[model samples]
Target chain A: LAKTTQPISMDSYEGQEVNITCSHNNIATNDYITWYQQFPSQGPRFIIQGYKTKVTNEVASLFIPADRKSSTLSLPRVSLSDTAVYYCLVGDPYNNNDMRFGAGTRLTVKP
Target chain B: SAVISQKPSRDICQRGTSLTIQCQVDSQVTMMFWYRQQPGQSLTLIATANQGSEATYESGFVIDKFPISRPNLTFSTLTVSNMSPEDSSIYLCSVEGTDYGYTFGSGTRLTVV
Candidate 1:
C-alpha cells in the first residue's frame, strides 16, 4: 500500500487558483492518482484522476510528472462552496479496492 | 456517474445494539466498498463487497464486528454489530465507476450511545 502525504490545511481566495499537492514516493508502476472532494456530513465526490502529464475536468485538473512520485490538484477558480477536504489517493486502477484515505487537506476558500 | 441511495441517513442506537445500513446503486457494479469516518478524522476502508462472495475486510476490521453482505451487483449492506461509542461514525457505501473514479452513497451517520 502506498501512503500519501499532503498539507493539513490551506487557504485560498475566491477567483484565485488553488493547488494542492500530494507526495507518494512509494507509488507503483500501475498506480494512478485520484482526487476527491468531501464536504461536512457527506461522502466524498470524485474530482479528477490522472496517470501522467495532466488531466482536466470541469471541476479540477490533476497534474503528474514523469516520475509520478507526486501530483497536484489544481482548481481553476475556487469559490466558497469549494471549501472542503480534498483527498489525494494513489492506487492501481486494476486493484483499487485497497485504496486508503489519509487526512486530507482542509481547503478554506475566502471571499 | 452512478447514483447511490443509502438507507437510514442518521440513526442513534443504544450500545450493544447493531445497525444495518443499506446501499442501492442505480447501475450494476463489480465491486462495492464500505468506509468509516470518525469525528475529526479521515475515511477508513472497512471492506470490499463483491456479489455472491464473502467480503474482504481491511486490517483491524473483522467480519464478526463489521459484517457485510452483497447479495447482488447493485445492492449491499453493512452491519456494525455490537455497537459501542467507538463505533459511532459516518459509514459510507461506494461503487467504482466504470471509467475513472468511484461514486459514493449519501452516507449514514451512526451514533451509538
Candidate 2:
C-alpha cells in the first residue's frame, strides 16, 4: 500500500476551480491514484482515477505526472454543495485489501 | 456500479450493548469491505468479508469485537460487540464495482450512550 499526503484543508469561492494535490512518493508500479469525495454523514463517492497523465470524468478530473509520485484532482466551477472532504488514495486496483485512505483535504466552497 | 442497502441507518445504544449492521448488495460480489469512520476522520478498513471463509481483519480490529458473517455473495453482517463511546461512528460497507472502483453504502451511524 502506498501512503498519500495532502493538505488538511482548502478554501475556495463558488464558481471557482479547485485543485487538490496529493503526494505519494513511494507509489508502486501497479499503483493507481484515485480520489473520492465525502459529504457530511455520507459515504465517500468516487471522483476520478488515473495512473499517469490525465483522466477526466463527468464529475472531476485527475492529473498525474510522469514520476507518478503525485496527482491532482481538479473540480471545475465549484459550488457550495461541493464543499466536502477529498481523499487521495494510491493502491493496486486488483487488490481490494490495500484500499486505505489517508487524512483527506477538506475543501470548503464558500459563497 | 453495485447498489448497496444498509439497515439501521442510525441507532442509539447503551454501552455494553451490541448492534448488528446488515449490508445487502444488488449484485453478487466476490468480496465486501467494512469500514469505520470516526468523527472528522478518514475511513478505516475493518475487515474484508469473503463468501465462504472467515473475514480478514485489519490491525487494531478483532473478530471478537467486530464479528462478521458473509453467508453468500450478496449479503453480510457486522455485529459490534460490547459497544463503547469510542464505538460510536459511521460504519459503512463497500464493494468493488466492475470498473474496480468502490461503491459504498450510505453507512449506519451508531451512537453509544
Candidate 3:
C-alpha cells in the first residue's frame, strides 16, 4: 500500500475555491489516485479518481502532476455544506484490499 | 454502483456484550470489506470477507474479537465480541462497485457503555 501525506485541516469561505493537495511519493505504476468526501455521521463518498493528468467531475477536479507523486483536489465555489473531511487514497487495481484511509483533511467552510 | 443496506443502524450495548451488524448489497459482489471509524477519526479496515472462505483480517484486528461471515455474494455479517468502550464507534461495510469505486453502508453507530 502506498502511504499518503496530506494536511490535517483546511479552512475556506463560501464561494471560494478550495484546493487540497496530497503526496504519495511511493506510488506504484499501477496505482490510481482517488479522493473521497465524508460528511458528519456518514460514509465517505467518491469525489473523483485519476491515474494521471487531470480528471474533472461535477463534484471536484483531480490534478495529478507529471511526477505522479502528488495530486490535488480542487473544489470550485465552495459552500457551507461542503464542510467535511477529505481523504486522498492511492489505490491499486490489482490489490485494492490493502488500501487504507488515513486521518483525512478536515475542511471547514465558514460563511 | 452497489447499494448496501446495514441493519441495526445504532445501538447501545453493555461492555461485556456483543453486537452483530448485517450488510446486504443489492448486487452480488465478490469481496466485501468491514471498517471501523472512531469518533472524529478516519476509517480503519477490519477485514475482507469473501464467499466460501474465511475472512482476511487486518493487523490489530482478530477473528475472535471481530468475527465476519459472508454467506453469499450479497450478504455479510460482522459480530463484535466482548465489547469495550473503545469499541464505541461507527462500523461500516463496503463493496467495490463496477464503476471502479467503492460503495459504503451508512454505518452502525455502537456505543458500549
TM-score of 2: 0.97
lDDT of 2 by residue, A9-110 (tens): 999999999999999999989888888899999999888878899999888889999999999999999999999999998888876536788999999999
Q: Whose lDDT is greatest here?
A: 2
Residue range B54-90, candidate 3, lDDT tens digits:
9999889999999999999999999999999989999
Interface RMSD of each: 0.8, 1.0, 0.9
Minimal lDDT window, size 10, model 1 chain A: A90-99
Question: How many angstroms is residue B112 displaced in model 2 relative to the true structure, after the best TM-score fit?
Answer: 1.0
Q: Work out the TM-score per prediction.
A: 0.96, 0.97, 0.97
lDDT of 3 by residue, A1-111 (tens): 438999999999999999999999998888998888999888888788899999998888999999999999999999999999999889785675445897789999999
Instruction: Between candidates 1 and 2, name the one with more favorable DockQ.
Output: 1
Sort the candidates on DockQ, descending order: 1, 2, 3
Model 3, stretches more than 4 Å misplaced?
Answer: none
The alpha-carbon RMSD values of the candidates against the true structure, listed in the order shown, are 1.2, 1.3, 1.3
Docking class of 2: medium
Model 1 lDDT tens row, B7-89: 99999999999999999999999899999998878999999888998999999999999999999999999999999999989
B22: Cα error in model 3, Å: 0.3
